[model samples]
Target: MSDNQPSPDTILRLINGYWSTGILGAAAAHDLFTHLEAGADSAAQLARRAQISERGAQTLLDGLVSVGLIDLAGGRYRNTAAASQYLVAGRPADLSALARLKLTHMGNLTALPEVVRAGGPVTDAAVEVADNPHWGQVVPAIAAQSVPAAAVAADVLQLERAGEISILDVGGGSGIYSATWLERNPAARATQLDWEPINAIARRLLAERGLADRFTCIDGDFHTTDFGTGTYDIALYSHIAHQEGPEDNIAVFTRLKDALKPGGALLVVDYVVDDDRAGPAFPLLFASEMLLKSKQGGTWRRADYHAWLTKAGFSDVSFHAAPPATLVIAR
Candidate 1:
C-alpha cells in the first residue's frame, strides 16, 4: 500500500480500546488506586491489600503504569498526576465512583447491538440511586463532577444581576448550581427539587458552604412534582433535557414556564446539536450514550429546543454562552 493509503492503526486502536477501560475499571473495583495512595505500592503489598494474587496484582499495576495512569519507580507503584486527581477516592473531584459505576454496569452494554438494531434500548430499566446500593458512589460523584460546571453556570447566568432572584432548580440533583448561584448572589434564594438521595446530598453540600440558609430542598421526581405556579423568578434545567425525549422536554418547559413569575427567565443547559445533526461530535456521541441509558433520551437540536419552548408559551427564547454545552434562556 502507498503511504497515502489509510492504515488500520486507528481501527485497531478502537478495537483494543476496552483493554484500558477494563484495566481502569478493575483498578477502581478493587480500590487499587486508593490503596496505592495509602502506601501499598509493591505488587505483593497491593495484592495482599486488595486480596488478589501477586501475579494478578503485578499485571494490573504494570498495565496501569504503561497507560500513564500510575507510575512505577524502584519497583514500587504510585498514581500519576491525572490518576491522583481523578481516580483516588475521597477527593472532591475524584471520578473513581464513575469507574465503579462502569464496573457495576459491565452487563449494561450487552444489549447495545440489539439496541442499535432496534433504534432503542432493549434492557429493562433499573432502579435509580434511591434503590440501588451500587449507585452510592455514583450519586456523590455526580455532584462532584458538576462543581466546575456549576461555577460556569453562575458566571453565565449573571446571578449577580439577578437581584433577589428566586430560582426553581428542577431536577437539581445535588444542587451544585443552586449553591454556586447563591455564592454569587447572596441576595438570591433557591428551591431545589430532585430525588431523596440527591436532596440529602444537596442539604449537606449547601450546609458546608453556609448556603443552606439560602436554599430549600424538595424531594420528588421532577416529571411528577407540583412546581407551584408563578413561584420562582428563574427556572433552571441543567444537564437534564438530554434525558428526555422532545415531547417530555416540551412538557417540562411548559410546566417550568408556569412555575416562573411573569417576565422571569427559564434556562436550559444541554448538549444541543446543530440543525443539520452532523458533526459537533460530542453532542452526537452523547445522543448515543443517552439512547443507551434511556429508551427515549437523545440530544436535540437548537431549533428543536426553540420550538418546544415557544410551544410551551415561552416568548423570546434565545441562546447564551456556556462552555461544553448549549445554554438557552427564555422569558
Candidate 2:
C-alpha cells in the first residue's frame, strides 16, 4: 500500500472491535479486575479463585493485557491504573457493570442494516421502552457512566451554594442526578419521574446511599405526566433527549420550562453533535445506535437544540461542554 493511500489497519480494527467488547465483558463478569486489585496476580491464582481452567485464565489475562486493561509484570498480572479505577467492582467510579451490560445489547447491533433501511427499529415501540424488563439492570449501569458529567452539572448549577431547593428529574434513571445534587446541598430534595420498575431501582440505590429521606419517585411517562407549574428549582432531562424525536423533545422542554420556578434552570445532558455533524467522532457514531434503536432519535446538532429550546419558551439558553456529554441549560 502506498503511504498516502488508505490503510487497511483502521478497517481491520473496526471490523474486529467486538473482540475488545467480548474481552472486557468476560473479564468484568468474572470480576477479574477486582480479584487483581485484591492481590490475585498469576493466572494460576485467578483460575483457582474463579474456579476456571488455568489455560482459560491465561488466555483471558493475555487478552486483557493486549487491551491495555491489565499489566503483566514478570510472572504476575495486575490491573492497569485505568482498569483498577474503572473496571474493578466496588470502586467509587467503577464501570465494570456497564461493560457487562454492553454484552447484553451487542447482538442488537446486527439488526442495524435492516433498521437503517426501515428508518428505525422494526417494532412500533422504541427499543428503550421495549426493553423495560432490563431497565432494573440497565439504568444503574448508565448511572455509573453519567457520574462525572452529573457532578459537573451540579457544580455548574452551584447546587452547593443554593438554599433548600426542589428538583424535578425527568426520566431520572437510578436517581444519580438527584443523589449527586442532593449530596451537595443537604437541604435540597428531588422527585424523579420514571417507570415504577426503574423508580424502584432508584429508590433502592438512593436509600443505600442514605439519601432516601431527601429523594422521592413519581412513576409515570414523562410525555403525559403532569409537571406541576412552577414547582421545581431545577429540572433535569439528562441522557433522555437522544432517544426522543424533535417534537417530543420540544414538548418535553416546554413542560420542563413550565415546571421550573422563577429563575429556575433546566439541564439537558447527552451526546450532542456539532451543527455540521461531521466530526466529534463519538457523538457522530452514537447516532447510528440511535438510528438502530429509536423511532426518530439521533445525536442532534447544537443548533437543533437551540432552536428546540427556544421554541419551547426557554428564553435564555446556553451550552456547556461536559466531557462524555454536553450540557444545555435553559431558563
Candidate 3:
C-alpha cells in the first residue's frame, strides 16, 4: 500500500473504536435526541435541560455531531435523521432503553480486560455481591423486545386450533412467548419454565397481559427439569439455545421433540449465522459477547440448527427470517 493510504486493518480498527459506544451512551444518558426532536438547541440550552455543566454538554455534543448522531447549525445542535428515528424517546423505533440497558447492565465492553485475564466467562461480580436479581430485573426489558418475536413465531408455528393444547416455553423469561400465544389462542394453555427468580417476573408479566389464567409459570432449570413427553402441541425454544453448546442444544431439541405430539411444531428464534460465519456483524459480535460471558454460549448457523432438528427426530426442519434474527421451525 502507498504511504498515504491506511492499511485495511488499521482502518477497520479506527472505525470500530470504543469511542463510538461512549458517545452513544452519553447521548442516551443526556436524552439529547429526545430534546432535539422538536428543534435544535444551543449547548447552553442543552446543558440546562440535561442538568449538566455547559462545558461537559458542549464536549459530548461536539463528539455526537462528529459521529453524525447530531447536526450543528448556527451553533445549535439537532438530532440527525438516524438518531431522531431510533434514539428519541416516545418514538415507535426508540431503542434508547436497549442502549441504556447495554451501558448500565451488560458492561461487557468494560470487562474485557478482566475476562481476558481470567480466560473464562466473566461473571457480574457486582450483581453477585449485591445479591441483585439480574435475570429477574432484566426479564421485563427482555420481554418487551421479545413481544414481536413471539408474535412472529406464533404465526409461523400456526397454533390456531387450540383445545387444551400444551405448550412449553423453555428458558422463557417473563413468559412473553406463552403469554402472546395464549392471548391469541384463548383455549390453549402454556407452561413457562425458567429460573426461580425469573419465574416471578414471568408471573408478573403474564398477569399484566391478563394471561395468568391460561399460563402457568414453573420455576426450574431446563437442563435438569423433566419437560414431560408428548404433551405439547407447540414447543418454543426462543433465544435460549445459543447460550449452550451444540451438544447441549441438540439434547434440548431432542427433549423438546419428545415432549411434542408427533405432528406438533417446535419454534426456535435466535441469531442464525451464515454458513461462512462472515459478515452480518451483529450476530457474530453478539456471539463474541456470549463467549465472553458464558461457558459455551455463541451464535449458530442455520444449517447447524437444521441438522440438529433433523437428528432430534423433527422432519421438515426449515429456517425463516424475522427481520434481525432467523426463526427455525420444525415438525
Candidate 4:
C-alpha cells in the first residue's frame, strides 16, 4: 500500500472511540479523579478509596494515563492538570457530571441510523423537551464548560465599563452568563428565560453564588414567551441554537433583537461551522448529535448565521472565536 492510499488507522480509531468514553465514564463513575486528587497515589490506595479491586484500579489508571488524563511516576498515579481542574469532584469548574451525562447520552448516538431515517429523535423526549428531567442534570454539568466563554463574552462587551446594563439571557442554563456579568459589573442585572424547573436550578445556583439579587428568571419557552421590546441592553442566545431548526432560530433571534434596546448587542454563542462546512472538526461532528436529538437541528455555518441575523433585522454582525465554540455579535 502506498502512503497516499487510505489507511485503516483512522477508521479503527473511529470504531474504537467508545473505548475512550467507556474508560473515562467508568473513572468518573468511580470518582477516580476525586480520589487521585485527594492523595490516592497508588493503585492499592485508589482501590481502597474508590472501592474497586487493585487490579481493576491499576488497569483503569493505566488507561487514564494513556488517555492523557492521568500521570504515573515512581509507581504512583495522579491526575493531570486538566483532569485535576475539570474532573475532580468539588472543584470550582468540575465537569465530572458532564462526563457522566455524555456517557448516559451515548445510547442516543447508537440509534443514529434510525434517527437519520426518521429525520429526528425517535425516542420520546430524548433532547428537545422543555421539562425533560435530562435538563436538570445537563444544565448544571455543562455550565462549567461555559465559564471561560462567558467571562470572555463579558470582557469582549466591556460589561465592566458599560455600567447599569440590563441583560436578557435566553435559555440561560445554570445562569452562568448572568452570574459572570453581574460579578464583573456591580450595576449589571440579568433575567434568564427558561423552563420553570431550569429556572429553579438557575435561581438556586445564582443564590448560591450570592447573585440572586441581581439575577432573576422567567419560566417560559423562548419560542412563544414574549421578549419585551427595548427592555435589555444586552441579549444572549447561547448554545440553544444548535437544537433549533433554522426557522425557529430566526424567529427567536428576531424576538431577541426586538428585546434589545437601541444600540444594544445581541450575542449568540454556539458550535458554529465554517462556511464551507469542511473542518473545525468538533462542530461538524456535533451536527450528528443534533440529528439524534432534534427534529430539524444541526450545526450551522457562518453564512447561515449571517443570513439569519440580517433577516432578523440586525444591521451589523460579527463573529468571534472563543475556542471549542464561537460567538456571533449583532447590532
Candidate 5:
C-alpha cells in the first residue's frame, strides 16, 4: 500500500487486536509492571521474580515491547512512560483493575456471534442491588476509577453556590459527586440513594470527606425506591442510564422529575452517541460492553435522550459533550 492510503488488511489486524489485549492482561495478571518497577529488567530476572519460565517471560516482554507498552534496550526491558504511570502498582492512575475488567469482557465478546444469531444477549447478567454477589467487588472497582471523571463533570456542571441545595444521587456508588459538589457548595447537602453494600461504601467515603453530617445514605433500588415528591433541589443520575433501555429511561426520568422540587433539575451523565451513531469510539465500544452484560441496554444518541426526557415531562433538556460520555440536564 502507498503512504497516501491504508491497506485493507488493516481491518484484519484490528479485528485480531486481541493479541495486544492478551499481552496486557497476562502482564497485569503476573504483576509484570510492578516487577519491572522493582528493578527486574532482564527476561530471566523477571521470570524468576514472577516464578515463571524464562521462555514465557521472553515472549511476553517481547510482545509488550513491540506494542510500545514497554521498552527494550541493551537486552533490558522497562515500562514505557505511559505504562509506568498507568500500569504500575503505585501510580495514582493505575488502571490494572480496568485492564482486568477488559479481560473479563473477552468472554462476552467471544459470544457475539451466538448473541447476534440468537437475536439477544448471550448473558443477561448485570449488577443489581438486591442480594447482589458482585457489588462488593464491582462497585468499588468501578467507582474508584470513575470518581475522577465525575470530578471533571462537576466542573462542567458548575453547580450553583446557593446554600442548602439538596441533591439526590441516584445509584450513587461512593457519593463522589456529592462530595465534590459539597466541597464547592459549602451549605449544600446530599442524599445518596443506591443499593445496600454500595450505600455503605458511600457513607464511609462521605464520612472520610468530613461531609457525613451534610449527607444521608439510603439503600434501595432506584426502580422501586420511593423518592418523596418535590423533596430535592436537584437529582444526579450519573452513569446509570446506559443500563436501561428506551422505555425504562423514560420511566425513570419521570420519577426523578417528580422527586425534584418544581424548579429543580436532573443531571444525567452517560455514554451518548451523535445522531448518526458513527463513532467517537468509546461509546461505540461501550455499546458492545453493555450488550455483553445487560439484557436490554446500550448507549443512546443525544437525540434519544432528548426525546425521552421530553416525553417524561422535563423541559429545557440539553446535551453537552463530556469525555467518554455526554451530559444531559433537564428541568
Candidate 6:
C-alpha cells in the first residue's frame, strides 16, 4: 500500500476506536449541537450561549470541525449535516441519551486494566444502581427500546392467537414492553417486575402513557421474588439475562417457565453472540462493557439460550434477528 494510504490494522482500530469519546461527551455536556441548531454562530457566541469560556469553546469547536462533526465558516461554527440531524437535542434522531451513557461510563474505563489483572473482579466495585442516580435513567431509555423489540418478538410469536394472554415482564423497568403489548392486544394484560426504584419510575411512566389501568407492577429483586404461578401466557425476559452468569440465567428462565401456563411463550431479548463467539462488533463490545461493569457481564450464544430454555422445560425454542441483537423465543 502507498505510504499515504492508512494500514488495514490502523483503519480497523480507528473504526473500533474510543478516541473520540471525550469529544462526544464534551459536545453533549455543552449542548453544542443544540446551540448550532438555531443557526451558525461564532465560537465566542456559542461559548456565551453554552456558558463556557470562549477560549475553551473555540478550541472545542475547531476540534469538532477537524473531525467533520461541524463546519467552519468566516470564524463561525455550525453543525455538520450528520451532527445537525442526529446530535441536536429535540431532533427525532438525537442520540443525546446515548452520548450521556458513554459519559457516565467513562470513569469505569480506568478500571479495565485493573479488572484484567485481577480477572474481572474489580468490576465488583463498579458503579451499581445504588451508587449512581443515572442508573435509574437507563431503565426508561431501555424501556423505549425494549417495548418495540418485544412487540416485534410478540408479532413473531403470534401472541394474538393465544387466549387470555398474561405477560410477565421480568426486570421490566418503565413497563414499556408490557404497555406496548397491552396497547396492541386489548385481551392481554401484563405484570412488570423490577427493582423498587426502577419500578417506581415504571409506574410513573405507565401512568403518563395512561397504561397504569392495564398493567401491574411488582417491585422486588427478580432473583428472589416469586413471579406468580401458572398465570402468564407470554413471559418476557428482556435485556437482563446477560448481566448474570449462565447458572443464574437458567434459574431465572426456570422460574419463568414455572410461572407460565402450559404452552406459554417465553421471550428472551438480548445481544446474542454467534455460537462460535468470534465476531459481530456490538455484542462483543457490550460483553466487554459488562465485564468492566457487571458481576456476570457477557453476551450468551443462541445455543446457550436454547440449552437453558430446554433445561427449563420450554419447548419449540426459536431465534430471530433484530437490529443490534437477537431474540430467543420458546414455549
TM-score for all predictions? 0.80, 0.93, 0.80, 0.93, 0.82, 0.80
Q: Rank the candidates by lDDT, best first.
A: 4, 2, 1, 5, 3, 6
- Over 202-311, each residue of candidate 3 has an lDDT whose tens digit, in order, gives 88877987888888877777888998998888888888878788989999999999999878888889988999998467788777666676777788987899898999
- In model 3, the Cα lDDT at residue 325 comes to 75
**Candidate 3: worst 10 consecutive residues by lDDT?**
124-133
Model 4 off-target regions past 4 Å?
Answer: 1-7
Badly placed stretches (over 4 Å) of model 2 are 1-6, 73-75, 124-131
Model 2, C-alpha of 298: deviation from truth (Å): 0.6
Ten residues in sequence with the least summed lDDT for candidate 6? 123-132
Better candidate by lDDT, 1 or 3: 1
lDDT of each: 0.82, 0.88, 0.78, 0.89, 0.82, 0.77
Candidate 6 lDDT by residue in tens digits, 69-109: 98877766788887877688765446666776677666667
Q: What TM-score would you give candidate 2 relative to the actual structure?
A: 0.93
> Which sections of candidate 1 miss by over 4 Å?
26-92, 126-135, 320-323
Backbone clash pairs for candidate 3 read none
Task: Supply candidate 3's per-residue lDDT for 71.
Answer: 84
* Predicted structure 3: lDDT: 0.78
Task: Please provide, for model 1 over 103-181, each residue's C-alpha lDDT reduced to its tens digit, 9 standing for 90 to 100.
Answer: 6666666778888998887766675445566444566666656665666667766889878989999888777788878
**Candidate 3: misplaced stretches above 4 Å?**
1-4, 7-16, 37-46, 54-94, 105-119, 122-132, 158-165
Query: Each model's RMSD to truth, in Å?
Result: 3.8, 2.0, 4.0, 2.0, 3.4, 4.1
Clashing pairs in 6: none
